[model samples]
Target: MRDGVRPPLRNHHEEAAEELGTTTKRDTINTALREVTARYRRLRALEEAREPAADGALDMDLLLDKRAYRPRGADSATDDHGTGADG
Candidate 1:
């Protein structure tokens, strides 16, 4: 690949190519195909395991409470601990 000729890896194929460290078109396409197939296999395994991993006593409403847990004066970007809200 030419220096300063590469564009931003906005698409999956480009991103996969970058991740695989391949410069050639054939290598990039092969890497992308491998990534997609690997992803599909992972998703299929998750789907197959879903039924066996189900918990009957799990409470979604209690576990997933939507109420904000910010302490007083935590409305600002950072808290007293100097950590941002996102942290």
Candidate 2:
């Protein structure tokens, strides 16, 4: 890993470290960076999905039909444990 000097952060390091289950500054920083990177990747994916195709026309039908992509048992009413009533 590359090492560089960073400005002193606010006093939340203790709280952040506790929340992230890390005891060292380096571990906490690494966990925080990974979370940020994952968040940005998810946002980028959503943005790309919203962009229109090269034809400038969006296929609203396929996008709106969520049932077509749902799993086989997704529509069944389940009990507290997620097993269907019949089970």
Candidate 3:
């Protein structure tokens, strides 16, 4: 790694590295890069799925309402103690 080339990491990256079980800066960078690449690939796959194929058939309405696929548990109702909605 080049000196002064790597940017300063914020608290979020530290927390993410801890969560990902990466102890060193090099491991954290490698893990973060892999995660970002995977996320982009997933997004690209979804974007491609929404595109019309050679058949010229596309379900715009279904694709537009993709939020329905999310897991439902929390109702966005927060508590007074500053806990999550499920609290």
Candidate 4:
């Protein structure tokens, strides 16, 4: 790195590399970039999910209705808490 070209990130890079156990600055930077991109991707996905779907594109209630969704062979006599209706 050229001296005095810009504010140095050496300290930050070294700290991140040590914490991450990366052997080189390049690896640390790449890992950081990949993590940042992954975080943004998750955020974008969450944002998109928050946006309302097209009409009937998805039934949010159906997804929320745990009673309607059951694992195969799960007893139908009980609610999600596993308490039977007779209780």
Alpha carbon lDDT of each predicted model: 0.70, 0.76, 0.73, 0.77
lDDT tens digits, residues 1-87, model 2? 127855456457877898999989999999999999999999998788777653457777776899767554544435434686566
- Tens digit of per-residue lDDT, candidate 4, span 18-75: 8878989889999989989999999999778766554556688887888776654445
- Model 4 error, position 18 (Å): 2.9
Q: lDDT rank, highest first?
A: 4, 2, 3, 1
The deviation in Å at residue 70 for candidate 3 is 23
TM-score of each: 0.43, 0.51, 0.46, 0.52
Candidate 3 worst ten-residue window by lDDT: 71-80
Candidate rank order under TM-score = 4, 2, 3, 1
Model 3 segments more than 4 A misplaced: 1-13, 53-87
Residue 85 shift from truth in candidate 2, angstroms = 20
Candidate 4 structure lDDT: 0.77
lDDT of 1 by residue, 1-36 (tens): 459676655565667768889987789888778889
Where is the poorest 10-residue window by lDDT in model 2? Answer: 72-81
Please identify model 1 stretches exceeding 4 Å from their true place. Answer: 1-16, 55-87
Point to the candidate with the largest TM-score: 4
lDDT of 3 by residue, 2-87 (tens): 58576556666788788899987789889989999999999998778757643458666665686766545554324434577565
Q: Which 10 residues in a row give candidate 1 its minimum summed lDDT?
A: 68-77
Clashing residue pairs, candidate 2?
A: none
